[model samples]
Structures are given as C-alpha cells and as structure tokens.
Target: MLIDIKGVLNLWGSFVRFTDCKGYPTMQAFMRESPQEREKQRYLPRLDDDTLAKVDRQIRKLDPAGKAKAYLANLAKPNDKREELESLESDELQFAILYLRYVAGLENKPIWQKLSLSKGAFENELRLAERFVEGVLIGSEIRLFL
Candidate 1:
C-alpha cells in the first residue's frame, strides 16, 4: 500500500491487509509494541513536502522500566482507528456514513434528496469527518495496524 490518503480511506473495512499484526483481537495487543519495535518501523506516511517532514521520528531507546508509562501515554491508538468517527453524534455519524457510502464519488445527483440530508448539516458533518479521518491517518502507526 502507498500509505497515502486514498490508501487510508481504502482501509475502511474491518481488516487492514498490509501489516504483520492481524485482526485486532485486543486493542492492548496493538498498543503493546516495544519502543525498539516502534523505532524500527515507520508509522506515519512520508510527507510529500520534505520541509514538512517530522524530525523526531529518529530512533530512540527508552528505558524498559517505562513501558507502562509509555503504554499509558499512548492508550488511544489501536489497530482500528474509529475513535474519531465513533465520537461523532448519532445523526452526524449517520450522515457521514451515508454520504461516504452513497454520495461522495458520484458526479451525478439523482436520488440525493431522498436521503433528506439538510445541505448545511450534511456538508458540515462531511467536512468534519474528512478532517477527523485525516487526523487519524496522520497519527496512525503502520506496524500497529492489522
């Protein structure tokens, strides 16, 4: 996989096919990777603009004693990164899903009004979802995904 925005969007279904870690049996399993392992992997995608690249991705060895501390610190990440999408309100989440599944790619509009989505609301939630997914992709760790 290219690990770009399109690649991240393609990872919508349950399983992430390109990584070693398989289905997320437990979120803990995803977060339990050792710092050495983390240092050995490239988590985020390579930025297109070299000037915008992250400098702190350099290898670093943290003390083994701080494993718990590190785990506690990064408790939010997981194999399935739906936390942001799940955080949306019920109606917003519904509209976001409907828009992505049914409306986003079509250049023609036929039964769009049947969805009964308010223009302002649908577009608002759609943009919000877009930003949320982008943030998730930006922070995602490739090795931790399954």
Candidate 2:
C-alpha cells in the first residue's frame, strides 16, 4: 500500500512531542519501545499473596445498594474528592468501588436505604466488580514477578 510520508511524519512528530513533554527521550523511543523495555515497563508496587486474598474477601463482601447510593451521591463530586472506599491498584479499583455501592442497597440491613436500584442493575454492578477484580488479579500476577 502506498503510504503518506507527510502523515506518517506528523504522527511520529506528535508521538515524540508527547513523550518529550513527559520527560522521556522523544522521537527515538516514543512508541517504539523494545520488547525488553516493554517488559520492564510493567512495574507496579508488589502486592503480597495476603494482600490479594484480603482484596478478594473485601470484594466478596461489597454492598451493591450502598454502592449505587454512593455512585449517585458522588456523581456531582469530583473524581478525587469522594471518600476513599479502598486503594485501587488499577482500573479494577474503579469498577470494584462502583460494584460495592450497587450491592449496598440490596442488603436487608443496608447501610443506607434511600435509593432503590433495579435487581438487574444491581446484578450488572456485581458483574462489573467481578470483572474488575479478575483483571486486577490477573494483571498483578502477570506483572508481579516482572
């Protein structure tokens, strides 16, 4: 296929600019990181087995309804201003927190009962939480030894 040099150069230049602004060596290594470097780039804080188990248990205990209320109440709140539910390790934290609030209202003696969420909605939230936890576990395990 015929390629456009101008477009390619522009894209490369944009990538270099982005990396350079982030204090990285720009044009040379912006998006062409070597396989070895890519392997090295997955550095995250090491989470112990115990920590993993703890998070698993916490996720299992998450309250769906409470999560819904929290999600709604915090809708108008800034991303970082809300009360911390748990220290999310990655994107998993995002979904897991939302799941907790959704399940909260389902409990008979729920923490807060002001809002009512549909049963389907509550289940969907739980599913999302499950996916998040799965991702967190898999991501951590794959990168833990790296």
How far is 118's C-alpha from truth in model 2 (Å)?
1.1
Which residue pairs of candidate 1 clash? Answer: 16-146
**Per-prediction TM-score, please?**
0.31, 0.28
Model 2: number of backbone collisions: 17
Candidate 2 global lDDT: 0.39
lDDT of each: 0.34, 0.39
Task: Summarize candidate 1's per-residue lDDT along 82-129 as a digit string, tens digits.
Answer: 232213344334433433343333321321233345666656654554
Candidate 2 segments exceeding 4 Å error: 1-49, 53-115, 142-146
Among the numbered candidates, top TM-score falls to 1
